[model samples]
Target: EAAVTQSPRNKVTVTGGNVTLSCRQTNSHNYMYWYRQDTGHGLRLIHYSYGAGNLQIGDVPDGYKATRTTQEDFFLLLELASPSQTSLYFCASSDGDNQDTQYFGPGTRLLVL
Candidate 1:
């Protein structure tokens, strides 16, 4: 089955810090995305790409960046992050089709203090 998951299920950091969270997929898919989940809010897309070496900014791209290093690996980068950036991050992947269903990861919990 096609699946996507993230690492470091929880994390804590201070203001103005750098954090890197990773995601991986086993579906051999060509589309990947990173989104943040917050209370009383819909999932906000941060970044996504069709394949490795390609990235497209989404709705909430500020203070966050992402990279698709390989077909099965993607990473999110938060540099000089702020408390506002603290939220649950989820990774997802699709089969590179417009109507393809997306598989979501468990998510990574981040806290900035």
Candidate 2:
């Protein structure tokens, strides 16, 4: 079974603060993604990478950045974070095959005050 894990399950930050969310997948998936969850917006993709050193920005790219270090690891960076960015962030991984399915982590709740 595919497994995904995230660190610092919860966070609180002031406006203009910075935060980095970490994710690791044990399924050795080739595709990884970062998403933020909020009311009215549902789950929106922030960034994704097909492989190491390859990143693709999602629809919402104003204040988010992402990096894929390896097949099993991905990171999301929130620089100059703001109160509006407070929400639950999720990391997901998939094999990108016909029978593959994306597996998501528990999620990190970030509160920007």
- TM-score for each predicted model, relative to the true structure: 0.97, 0.94
Q: In model 1, what are the clashing residue pairs, if there are any?
A: none
Question: Highest lDDT, which number?
Answer: 1
Tens digits of lDDT, candidate 1, 1-113: 68887998998999999999999999899999999999888799999999999999999999988999999999999998799988999999999878999999999999999
lDDT of each: 0.93, 0.91
What's the true lDDT of residue 30 in model 2?
A: 90
Task: Point out where model 1 deviates above 4 Å.
Answer: none
Tens digit of lDDT per residue, candidate 2, span 1-113? 88999987999999989899999999878999899999888999999988988999898878988888888889998888899889999999999885888899999999999
Q: How close is candidate 1 to the true structure, as a TM-score?
A: 0.97
In terms of lDDT, the poorest run of 10 residues in model 2 is 93-102
